[model samples]
Target: MSKATFAGGCFWCIEAAFSSLEGVNQAISGYCGGETDTPSYDAVCSGKTGHAEVVQIDFDDAIISYQDLLTIFFTLHDATQLNRQGNDIGTQYRSAIFYHDTEQQQQAQGYIDALTQDAVFDAPIVTQVTPIDTFHSAEDYHQGYYQQNPSQGYCSMVISPKFNKFKAKFGHKMKP
Candidate 1:
């Protein structure tokens, strides 16, 4: 299995988006890229821990390529936005792709370059492609938040739109 960490706005939304992919073995919401020892949901949300709300995805390479994952990641969120995605504005909600290996890093940079060259977004892509440092699991309530709390205001209003867009764009690649 290969791993990829991404912070594209809320971790709940990111988790829900990637969890639908066919080759994604698991997508766990967590806190990463911070200085805190063991960040909690509240601490991260407070933005005091400097941790970005991220999703750690485990995938089978035989079923999905890292490049494919990059494509999906770029499409699932507005890479053009910097330090924010929609109303969630904070360092913890920044757009980032945390790669584990050189291959993943190259693929991510390649995808960003291609998208920029193709004029994929009206504005420039501000997505940060960085290396993974540490990932601290979020509180249990945060895990599968969108799936577990579909009717919650944030999930229904914010996350569902992204989920719907992803389904429309990549439904052919979704799990059975």
Candidate 2:
């Protein structure tokens, strides 16, 4: 298994997307690219921990390549929207890829470059490609949140639509 950490707005939405993918063994909502030691969700949400609400994924590389994961991440979130996805605004929501290795870093940068060269969006892509120094796991309440709380307000209104679109676009890539 290989690791990939990404911050594209709420961890809930990111987790929801990757948790359904075929090769993904874990899509854990966590905090990364932060200054604090074991920062709490409230602290991260306060926008002071310098941390983004990230989902750290463990996947089978044989089943799904890092490039494919990057493709899905960019597709699921608005890479041009810096520090926010809809109303979830703050540094905690910034679009970023906390790369685990040199290969991941290079792939992420190359993917962004390709998107830029292809003019995939009118606005420039601002998703940061940074190394993940430490990945702080969030409280247990946050794990599998979308699956457990589908009827919750934020899950219903924010995550459901995005997850539906992801499922529709990548149904062939989903697990049985």
Candidate 3:
């Protein structure tokens, strides 16, 4: 199994998207890329903790390659949008890939380069590709939030669109 950590706006949407995939063993919604010892959702949301809402995904490489995961990551959200996704606007919502190793970093940079060359977006991709730091698990209520609160205002308004897009594009790759 291999792991990839990413911050693409709300962790709930990213967690739900990757968790639904076939080879993904787990998709943990948490906080990372910050200086705090243990950051809370409220603290991160305030943009004072310097944390980004991230999801740590564990998956089988034999079933899904890192490149494939990176591709899906790029497509699921607006990478060109800096520090925000939809109605949620804050540093916690920044697009980032917290790479575990040099290989992951290279692949992430390569994909960003390819996307830029292909003009994937009208604006430049602002997604940060950085090394992994201490990942502080969020409060229990934050984990599996979308699954538990499917009809909640934020999930319905902000997360569902990305979920729908992933389902439309990668549904066949998901677990049966």
Candidate 4:
């Protein structure tokens, strides 16, 4: 299995979007790219830890390539949005790819470069492509949140719509 980490907004939304994909063993909500050690959800949410809310994905490379995961990630969130996604605002909500290896880093940078050269969006993609650091798993309540709290307001109002869009676009990649 290979691992990839990304931060595109709320970890809840990112977790939900990637968890259903084929070859994805798990999508864990966490914090990364920060100075602090063992960052807590509250500390990260306050944007004081410099940690972006992220999802650490474990997947089988034989089944789905890292570039494919990047494709789904870019589709799931607006890379052009800076320090925010929808109404959520903070550095913790910034778009980022915490790469695990040189290959991952190259692929991420290449994808961003291609997107820019092709004029993929009206606004420039502001996603930070950085080396992977400590990944502090969120509280247990935050794990599988969308599945566990489907009717909750945030899940229903925010995550669900984004999840639905991802599912619509990548339904073929979803597990049975």
lDDT of each: 0.88, 0.95, 0.90, 0.94
Once model 1 is optimally superposed onto the true structure by TM-score, how far is the C-alpha of residue 123 displaced, in angstroms? 1.2
Worst 10 residues of 4 by lDDT: 37-46
TM-score of 3: 0.96
lDDT minimum window of 10 residues, candidate 1: 74-83
Regions more than 4 Å wrong, model 3: none
User: How well does candidate 1 match the true structure in TM-score terms?
Assistant: 0.96
- Model 2 Cα lDDT, one tens digit per residue, 66-163: 99999999988999998998998999999999999999999999999999999999999999999888899999999999999999999999899999
Worst 10 residues of 2 by lDDT: 126-135
lDDT rank order: 2, 4, 3, 1
| Alpha-carbon lDDT of model 2 | 0.95
Give the per-residue lDDT of model 4 (tens digit) for 26-79. Answer: 999998998898899889889899999999999999998999999999998999
In Å, residue 42's CA in model 2 sits off its true spot by 0.6
Please identify model 4 stretches exceeding 4 Å from their true place. Answer: none
RMSD of 4: 0.7
- The residue pairs in collision within model 1 are none
Candidate 1 differs from the real structure by a C-alpha RMSD in angstroms, to one decimal, of 1.0
- Cα deviation in Å at residue 100, candidate 2? 1.0
The candidate maximizing lDDT is: 2
